[model samples]
Target: MLANMGNEIYRKIEQVKLLPLYTATDLTYLDRLEDILVKNNVRFIEVTFRSDLAIEAIKKLSQSNELIVGAGTVRTQKEAKDAIENGAKFVVSPAVVPEVIEYCIEQDVPVFPGTATPGDIQRAMEYGIKVVKFFPADIYGGLKAINALSGPFYDVKFLPTGGINEENFMEYVQNDHIVAVGGSFIISESLIKKDDGETADKALKSLIDKINLQK
Candidate 1:
């Protein structure tokens, strides 16, 4: 189902892809992005620990109590725990790490670890995970990579992150195997910096609307 996932993965993507960052600006930008995402019907948020005030931000977003939030760029187990502790509903990584992946599974916390090649996909498969993020997606051949993986790994679903954007967004998600996509392009740091909250929000709304458009 092209709904949120596993339909398991999508519950994971919202937490990861929606991980937007601030420009060389203040923390209040999140307020604007929040309004945009909420109005646009973007159901997921990727909250990575890489940001300056991640825990606090996670706490803040949690307060809104809307959208399925998750941690992104999760490299260590400690980060994963912190995100969950701060109210992340799931976790996502830029690449596959057996221990980290298993840690989520062990806690039954749901994870969307990254994969770029068949070997990486196999590693995810070894653990019996159904959904994975295709990272550095553009560099690794973008849709071609997904298309190739689908040949042997039919049951596996992907949330292609990294370079996904408006131009090619529909191109990827419209496919049978691509469950969703992740990227910062839809809601950018630049837009946040300019203090154009409404414009940014409208852009995000348009993107989400485009995704839900009928063929």
Candidate 2:
């Protein structure tokens, strides 16, 4: 049952192809963000645990049947437990935390832990995880690094996050090794903080259009 659930979520992630990494500082803008995502037909969102309101944001957004809400920047089992209890359908961490990964797998929630080096990917592979996040992708050699890593770990897939933007995100997304590209480029911090729904909507639509055009 748990493996089936994981496969289901993985299909959704692949279909979306773009995972919006969101950080909610103020609770008021979540509705606006959700509205924009739904309007643009975006089905997956990773609400990072970067703010005090993150748990509440996850709870509120996950209530919507239209979205698959996940928790990001999670670094511990306690945080993972909190996110799941509040309705996060998946869990993402900045680094591979054994406890968190073990906990998520035990609960049957999909977990995408961050990886930067071969050692990190090797560790994650030991847990039977195929898809992992290539964090700070830009600083860590971007697609070049992923290409290198893929040589040894041929079956591993990546969700490249950090430093991904409108200019280079497609480059990562186009790679077969990447499951989906994630970052704050589309739904930026400024846009969310200012509650600029129009800009946010346009950005998301534009990217979605680009992705569609690529196909």
Candidate 3:
């Protein structure tokens, strides 16, 4: 039953196509970020657990049902619990941790743990994970790596993140095996630091325009 619930959440992400992986030290940027996402027709955002304010950010953003907010960079079981309590609809980890995955399973929340090698992917599969995050995708050979895994892991889907930008994003998302492409390209830390909505809007609109044209 929990596994079925996870798949339901995964389908929602697959429909969106783009998953903006954001990390901000300041909580002030989340609202503005949501505005930019909504304007560009994006429905989901992952607030990374890299900062001390990640939980607060997720809580604040989850108040609105219009946005699908999640917690990223989750490492420990405790973090997973905390994220869910704060209203994270899903949880993502940089690497697969059996304990953390188990915690998410018990809570019945979806999880996308990072997997690099075949061994990592295999281990995640044993944990009933059907989808995973391909971290550092550019250096990990991008589509080449995903293609390689597709042969053996035919039932699995991937969300490639890291080093992904508008210039080469379609290459990853266009593939059937990839559920979505995640990166900070559309909302980079530097852009958030500037706090200039006009500049950010232009960049986001350009990306969205390209995406629509591709479709």
Candidate 4:
């Protein structure tokens, strides 16, 4: 089982407690953005499949050994396969899709499927999934939901995404149950359009500084 091979996803998150969720419809700024992420010491990043350029970008970024690239918003088996075949180190979904989870497991790829309710968590457990994404976290009650799930699902870990920003991110990370937090507010798409990366670089550095200070 891939589970026995060791959970690389958790290992990466433990090393650096932040996962920047990025989506770029424009491929022009990908290289510069990757540089900014690396400069801030971000070892793991999710290049979401929100655009056509996402696959190509993942392929380009994964060529670098310095960064562990993952595909986010993967909703289908084909998308999962494409991402993994193109060198995505992991896969993430906004909701649970049993087939997608099964395919990833079969391929020995780590996947963080989204779980919003007790039923979702239970189903994921059935699939032998160790980690999941508590998506749209803020709107679904944030830390409270995570705490509630801890009682019965203590072994399961979470990567909370959606509505996470600088202010509340530290709060989420403080919880040991939360493996990582995914946010795109600081690495705004508009900033990427600037091309020079000065704005994105500054924002990333500040966020990384805060994470280091808390540690």
Top candidate (lDDT) = 2
**Pairs of colliding residues, candidate 2:** none
Q: On a 0 to 1 TM-score scale, where does candidate 4 land against the true structure? A: 0.94
After superposition on all CA atoms, what RMSD does each candidate show versus the true structure? 3.7, 1.4, 1.4, 1.4
Cα deviation of 168, candidate 3, in Å: 0.7
**What's the TM-score of each model vs. the native?**
0.87, 0.96, 0.94, 0.94
Q: Among all windows of ten consecutive residues in candidate 1, which has the lowest summed lDDT?
A: 16-25
lDDT of 1 by residue, 59-98 (tens): 7777878766778888888888787888877788889976
Better of 1 and 2 by TM-score: 2
Tens-place lDDT digits, model 3, residues 1-215? 55799877788778778888788787777778888888887888898888888889889989987688899999999889988999899989999888889999888889899998899999999988889999979889899999999999999999999888889988877899999989888675568567556787788788777767777
Count of residue pairs whose backbone atoms collide, per candidate: 9, 0, 0, 0
Q: lDDT (0-100) at residue 185 of candidate 1?
A: 75
Write model 2 residue lDDT over 51-70, tens digit each, in one string.
88889999999886779999
- Clashing pairs in model 4? none
Model 4, stretches more than 4 Å misplaced?
Answer: none
Residues 32-129 of candidate 4 have per-residue lDDT tens digits of 87788788878788889898888998888888777889999999999999999999988899899988898989888888899899998898888888
Model 1 TM-score is: 0.87
lDDT of each: 0.72, 0.88, 0.86, 0.85
Off-target runs (Cα >4 Å) in candidate 3 are: none
Candidate closest to the true structure, highest TM-score: 2
